[model samples]
Target: MSKSQGYDERLAVPLRWWAQGTMLVATLWLTVVVAVPGPTAWVVTGVALALLALLLWSYGDARVVVRDGWFQAGRARIEAEYVGEVAALDAEQTRLVAGRDADARAYLLLRPYLHRAVKVEVVDPADPTPYWLVSSRHPEALADALTALPKTR
Candidate 1:
């Protein structure tokens, strides 16, 4: 089967979050430079930089893509035929699905920082997973793509 992309997006950490994290790292470095003795301050800064780099690296790879009749969120991919009831959720609803009323059997690709998300019901009876809750910066678009899977297939 020919693979074609229907919707592709990375739920990137917002720019403001990057800015805030950078500022926080700088603050920690400055605090260390002022209070800590010896070369420990520079060591602390290096460790902080390493941690920041690791954080950005991991966050950068997470993506949501609809292609080849499949929907991928983070590390999980499900065929479009098994995806149903695509719901675009606002911040409050997203939080509720991801937190308070969350199901243990549901697959979640959530980013707590991203307020918007899409909930897709899984129709495969053999699969124990009931649904997938995924973070999306463009929830409506993601939901639309998911709902339109039948046409794409």
Candidate 2:
């Protein structure tokens, strides 16, 4: 069975268009920041640019891969052997986890802009980590795919 999740191209196309449309916005801001050049402004501008880059990468690289019996998200990949359970989580639930762990990270495949999410229990015995909380706009599909996978021993 084929299983995977990704951002809506229709939804993301506009986002990319908007990002590209606003590309020139950076140059203008940089010019203003440079012309009035101050230490604080420079720092702020630098930070803003970094944030833009991160946002772009986060959206551009957003995807979920569940093929050949594998689940891939960002830089991590898992197989059924390493997956325990797949459950849907909304904004409230996600916030709960976010509040607890300072270093917690989730590879969101759906709702880049939404507050809802999904948590998957990875069954990897090699690692102590129990599960991953991923933000997904299409939580039901994600859960279904994950739940259908055969657990690996």
Candidate 3:
């Protein structure tokens, strides 16, 4: 098991995705070189590569963190006091929850690349969102960290 820094996880895309993306960019470079065949082709390929890099970096920048009496998934956060009933979901369970049994008002921090997730119930009655479904590579660890949080309320 990994040491818990209060359960911090970055949802990075797999390396295979990077490899495939790079190959695609190479293909784009080839097409541009064959069609245009000048400095314009180099410029076009460079811009396309830069854009691809930026998109992948931004897409993988999302994070899930639980620390200092708070839980966060991507841009959304909630106090630990308001969190309840954390569950670690396997691939099948996550698919079912995210697809068949999803609540309309639930806050989901889902990534297509991630198949496992953690379901966190929101106990705050004032909040409109019912629960949070956050994708995690290590869902059990995340659930354990969340469960260990001290609820002030």
* Pairwise lDDT winner, candidates 2 and 3: 3
Ranked candidates (lDDT, high to low): 3, 1, 2
lDDT of 3 by residue, 1-153 (tens): 343568899999889888999999899999989999989988998898899889998999999999989999999999999999999999999999999999999999999999999999999989989899999999999999999888898
Ranking by TM-score: 3, 1, 2
Best TM-score among the predictions, by candidate number: 3
By TM-score, the better pick of 1 and 3 is 3
Which tens-of-lDDT digit does each residue in 1-153 have in candidate 1?
Answer: 112347888777767777877898899988999999679998998899889877976886699998768899998999988897889999999988988999999998888678889999998889999999998888888887887676433
TM-score of each: 0.83, 0.62, 0.96
- Which stretches of model 3 miss by more than 4 angstroms? 1-4
Report the C-alpha lDDT of model 2 over 10-127, residue by residue, as the tens digit.
1232366457635755775677677777676667667776776676655656566555567676556887778877888777777776556523444334444657667887566666
Model 1 lDDT, full chain set: 0.85
Model 1, C-alpha of 116: deviation from truth (Å): 1.6
Model 2: lDDT to the true structure: 0.63
- Candidate 2 lDDT score at position 106: 44
Clash totals in order: 0, 4, 0
